[model samples]
Target: METAFTPFQSLAGGALIGVASVLLMGLMGRIMGATGVLAGLLMPANLADWSWRAAVVAGMVSGPIAVMLVTGEFPQVQVPVSSTMLVIGGLIVGVGVTFGAGCTSGHGVCGMARLSPRSIAATLTFMLATGVTVYVLRHVMGG
Candidate 1:
């Protein structure tokens, strides 16, 4: 429940994220939304663009894995729920991925970078929904 990250570590992580976002947008002219990238990979018409998207996703995934392998500093995750609950949560997230027209990474990082109004709305919705969900599940539902 408690994070072991020092203030410096947290700040460095935030800085790295910002740097990566800037580089990704400036260099690729692409939104770094994991879901959209993966969806592009799944589309037959997007075969020509698959490699870059796949690499982006791979790099994002592999970066953390590499860190854990090298430093053995994997962060702990605590989810006080059953597999069924997790599955339900996943389904809800999937729906959000579809309805929101972009995932948090896409809207928060990429859209915000482009100064998009839709992205701003989407990001606010994500924050508000997450806060409300947490409150309901932890307090109202006594989960």
Candidate 2:
């Protein structure tokens, strides 16, 4: 399957992510690692921490709502795979995150911005794995 080249949209989205992460770091002095945020939400250290985490999560879940308010329609999403495949993929990601200590949003975005060595390594590994996965799925496995 051919991938669509959405440079503008991708740039805008990436900029938003960078701004949000920078704002979070600047205002709260916290790195905006999504998985870390979610985990903190699950068991917060205190009320202040919980409130911020809740707000971050709220913003995350309300993204489509914000788009609908601005564009007058919810963003369209497409999922080509079955629910089982999605679940399997999620499980695989969970295992990877557990072993890697954080997700791409954390390492790729926040960690790299901080010039963290571990994050740099993790991001490289993530990129390499993604390229290999895509190559195998598209060419080797003929998916």
Candidate 3:
């Protein structure tokens, strides 16, 4: 089936993300990277840091719920893979985060925004890898 493209919704979501990132960095002195934030919870420097990390995670989880409550429907989601594949993919991503030192949100959004060379390189690598993977899957493997 054809899906609807909502440019206004996409723009609003991106604007909200930008505003939240700025406010987070300005007020809390933290980068609004979900993986890094979640990782911090696993290895917090001090006890006080845990509270804000928990709150951030809680907010992430609650966002979709809040949207559903306000709109009376959840956003459409389609997963073509099996549940086992999903779990395995998540585990692989977790391991990748450890090796890469950060995930896409950390390197692509927050890092690039800060004009860090490391992040710039990491984002480029991410895009290249993604492009190659898609090509392999769609063309080579007939996925």
Residue runs of model 3 more than 4 Å from their true location after superposition: 1-6
Instruction: Tally clashing residue pairs in candidate 1.
Output: 0
Number of the top-ranking candidate, with lDDT as the measure:
2
lDDT of 1 at 120: 97
**What would the per-residue lDDT of candidate 2 be over residues 45-68, giving only the tens digit for each residue?**
999999999999998899899889
In angstroms, give how far residue 97 of model 2 lies from its true place.
1.0
Highest TM-score against the true fold, candidate: 2
Give per-candidate clash totals. Answer: 0, 0, 0
What range of 10 consecutive residues in model 2 has the weakest lDDT sum?
A: 1-10
Candidate 1 vs candidate 3, lDDT winner: 3
lDDT values for all models: 0.81, 0.93, 0.86
Query: Which pairs clash in the backbone of model 3?
Result: none
TM-score of 2: 0.95
Candidate 3's C-alpha lDDT? Answer: 0.86
Q: Cα lDDT of model 1 overall?
A: 0.81
Candidates sorted by lDDT, best first: 2, 3, 1
Each model's RMSD to truth, in Å? 2.5, 1.1, 2.1
> Per-residue lDDT tens digits of candidate 1, residues 42-124?
87356558887777778777766776897798755667779998999889999999999989988998888788999999999
